[model samples]
Target: MTFIALTKPQMRGLLAKRLRFHIVGVFAVSLGIAAFCKFAVAKPRKKAYADFYRNDDSMKEFEEMKKAGIFQSAK
Candidate 1:
């Protein structure tokens, strides 16, 4: 006479199963990415940007300021 729907227990069990599947999918994706990085591409090394400064004028100014104790001047 009446149609039956999912009960609380049935809904909870379904949600639990779905959550388990999602967790497993995430783990599988993470493993795939790690494997790809390990076998496909080598990690890049650190590149120095300090090469942009050729003469080091900023360095000399810093040393001069330190000698003159300009940082202690009251502003």
Candidate 2:
């Protein structure tokens, strides 16, 4: 087997040639992670918020706020 040595210019050219594919690979990976977060992480978080609000007692909260004097009655 023969070993071949690349000069700095040749190495730079090779890196430049491969840069597009590297950039595309990184972009694809970023898109995949975003998709996973949207579907897996965000969906569950959204559902949890929905469930919490669905079971929330607005009247009870209003009474609590009234007791706490958070609202001022306008004369």
Candidate 3:
């Protein structure tokens, strides 16, 4: 195989060319992580919240609080 030598300016140009590819790679990775958080992480957290609130009884809680004298009526 023949060896090729690059000058300083040629090396700088090559690095400049590769910088675009690196930027695109970083952008793609960040998009993938954001998608994973939105779908995998956020969806499950939202579902858990929905499931928890599905069986919630606000009136029952208010009655329990009333029984415990947590509120006082205005005269």
Candidate 4:
């Protein structure tokens, strides 16, 4: 198949249009990403549980009470 050649002015105009389209596309994409990061991502919760460790006495006490059925488990 023979290739169709574009005239110089036509090619230049096409290039400029393509460049403008790419620039606008990139700018819009960047704005979308920034907006998503600012508004869509979950913010760190101010309330977080303290780190639980087995050495914590309250955890052990609750476990023991459950095993002893002090609250009378239906099972």
Predicted structure with the largest lDDT when compared to the true one: 2
Cα lDDT tens digits for candidate 1, 20-68:
9999999999999998886666433112234445545886787788788
Tens-digit lDDT string for candidate 2 (6-69):
6655644787779988999999999999999999999999999999999999989888888888
Location of the lowest summed lDDT over 10 successive residues in candidate 4? 42-51
Q: Give lDDT per model, in order.
A: 0.72, 0.90, 0.89, 0.70
Structure candidate 1, residue pairs in collision = none
* Clashing residue pair totals per candidate (backbone < 3 A): 0, 0, 0, 0
Q: Give lDDT: candidate 3, residue 10.
A: 67
lDDT of 4 by residue, 2-62 (tens): 9999766564479889999999999999999988776656332222223334236886788
The 10-residue segment of model 3 with minimum total lDDT is: 6-15
lDDT of 4: 0.70
Per-residue lDDT value at 62 in model 2:
89
TM-score of each: 0.40, 0.60, 0.68, 0.41
Cα-lDDT of candidate 1: 0.72
Error of 4 at 21 (Å): 0.8
Rank candidates, TM-score, best first: 3, 2, 4, 1
Q: How far in Å is the alpha carbon of 64 misplaced in model 2?
A: 7.6
List, residue by residue over 1-75, the lDDT tens digit for candidate 3: 998896655644788789989999999999999999999999999999999899999988888888888889711
TM-score for candidate 1: 0.40
What's the C-alpha lDDT at position 67 in model 1? 85
